[model samples]
Target: MQALTWWRNPGTKDLDAIVCDGSVRAGKTVIMSLSYVLWSMTDFDAQQFGLAGKTIGSLRRNVIRPLKIMLHSRGFHVKDHRSDNMLEVSKRGKVNYYFLFGGKDEGSQDLVQGLTAAGFFFDEVALMPESFVKQATARVSVEGGKLWFNCNPAGPYHWFKLEWIDKLKEKRALRIHFTMQDNPSLSPSTIARYERLYSGVFYKRFILGLWVLADGVVYDNWAAETMTTHIDDVSGYESYYVSCDYGTRNPTVFLLWGRKDKVWYCLREFYYSGRESSNNWDDSQYVTAMGKFVGTIKASIIVDPSAASFITALRKAGYQVIAADNDVINGIREVQNAMNNGKIMFADDLKHMFAEFSSYIWDDKAADKGIDKVVKDHDHVMDALRYFVFMVIYKQRTATTAKKPVWLR
Candidate 1:
């Protein structure tokens, strides 16, 4: 396992220095120092070394201890660190280096001040203030010593993030996102402990190596006002078909779409339900309410095949009701086809549907990386949309009715 860790990152030539990028137990500090002793020795000139973290305590623990072990194993000799907690490394005859300093100290730049370093490493970079990190980077006057920055992504705006990731715009620093699984040495129990302790956004970000946004926002691309075209008058909508995902406990949702002037416009949506008692309407009432909605809009309806009961209720109200063929996988294919062809259109008011549209991910299960929807709650509006597409387009059989549901809708 250690051999694999050693092999995973064979040092690059440009790495007059290299920064190890990984999560907490990813052996970053171990890998960095190993690369340093093995790779940096060949480079000529004075070697200045720096190590720091957000606090003196972390400097003593996470960074220094592991680094010292790696250096010793790799045969680099270290002078005794002073009472002031500074040390240096040497190889046989010609070596220049200084040891750990505390980034945890808010006033740490003074300690790093005026030093020409072969390289400098900033561990747990998110915890350091932006200014202190900037000052440290500025201090590396050595002609080619690499500046080291490594950390689990914390708040996205950390200096390492702003400069190297977000703002550098160019790939100046080699960055990697590593997970606990990458380490391979940790016991299953240890991994489980971390998993049990961390969940939601935190667990995914730190443990699973996902670059996810907090607050559980499934769709970042959803735009109500821009992605949609609004229409107030219903005159030109022509005949309409409504498609629904009927649920008594969850929100009952329906998409109202139609063909007009040879264009598909999804201009409206119906969404509501019975709550625990008062706020949400019940199943029968919800179906009747949908009947009233269909009457008001005066549209023909096709519903999810799974909701046979709802179709019965709609038909009993003297409305033309048909079962929507649900080919979830194919429905997704049709939707993708329309979007790729620039035929899909939405209206400003259908915010929930827009949310589903933005969040509907491809089921790339073979990747086994959990990139698609497995929880299913976020796909409610999408199921309604799939029915809309199944009924409107991708029907396979042409209807005798004149504008046989334009597949683009």
Candidate 2:
């Protein structure tokens, strides 16, 4: 409430911006977005403004939909020009225009280059590149223009943390830190459910709302004894999948997965290290081995995106191959979440995968540079596991869970 009236309040009138950073489901996004709209409508007239998220689709789903409802209930007229990605809002003869933007990558700066905005609201600003933020902020040139930022915390050395957050006084920005406790809408059970969704670095960032390092093992939830399933004890397979990490000079690994109910079992593994072998297998030879490994089992094969030749060989051999979604960080998080939720279990006989799991650790050097990376060593099987869980299982689950609004339907 205070943040919404900050500009009007004599004590905080001099502040130039507002930043809300905190835990997930903590009310930062809702409150900050609402405040931005209210502040813009109250203070400005017939002006251009900007509202952005990591992607236009996300911005609409997270901010625009709920915002439209709130405004309508408040007796304001809202016209969405979907084709133009703009909103025409008015109340009591007062009007304003809000343009939408997606700050998804380094090239996103081009999207906001020509706009002259009275203010800009960035949701999940930490996910956007520094270049996009700089370009977006530069467009807010109108007098009394302000910036509004809301995001879950990232690394300790993230640009926003180093600049806007650490130098809050210098930037004259009001920083509001939030936790799940601040969101009255979330019941205790809901908050607890969200808390169980993350562990290790993610837990610290999304649950505790801390800007800390992602150090130690990447999968703190992994345990060979508890996470592995005996093949003889499982049955009733619904489908099967083969996830591959193809390498010529390095190591090539293929993990065979089978699903039963909500749980996916890593049934078997085929690991070959070319460096350790006297001969490096060609694409055809690798395909032959994969055929033998997957004999008579109809399964979708997911392979590393870089293995073009290998993928062609598989396809030529009458096998269906899918290029894995190779987003390392997101993949790792999904895999970790699967483990935390008991969605995945490995066969006890898969010795090589268990070995790789125990040895896979976060790259401290990368963390020190404010980057999240796992050590490349001992990760072939782990990569294959990540590919299957993230692309096939996690994506399907996410799509299934995201309910579209009634109007959109």
lDDT of each: 0.61, 0.89
Cα lDDT tens digits, model 1, 225-313, are 54467678655676677778877667778777777765567767887754534475654686677766655777777777777777787
CA shift at 275, candidate 2, in angstroms?
A: 1.2
Q: Once superposed on the true structure, which residue ranges of model 2 sit more than 4 Å away at CA?
A: 233-235, 401-409
User: Which candidate wins on TM-score?
Assistant: 2
For candidate 2, the 10 contiguous residues with the lowest summed lDDT are 400-409
Per-prediction tally of clashes: 10, 0
Q: What tens-digit string does per-residue lDDT give for candidate 2 at 1-409?
A: 7656777888887789989898999888777777788888999999999999999999998899888888888898889889999999999999999999999999999999999999999999999999999999999999999999999998888888998999999999988889999998999999998888899999999999999998888888787878886787433589989999999979999888888887899998999998998679999889989989988889989999999999998998999999999999989888888898889888889989878777899889987777778999999999999999999878887788667677542
lDDT of 1 at 51: 73
lDDT value, residue 292 of candidate 1: 65
Query: What TM-score, over all chains together, does every model reach?
Result: 0.47, 0.95
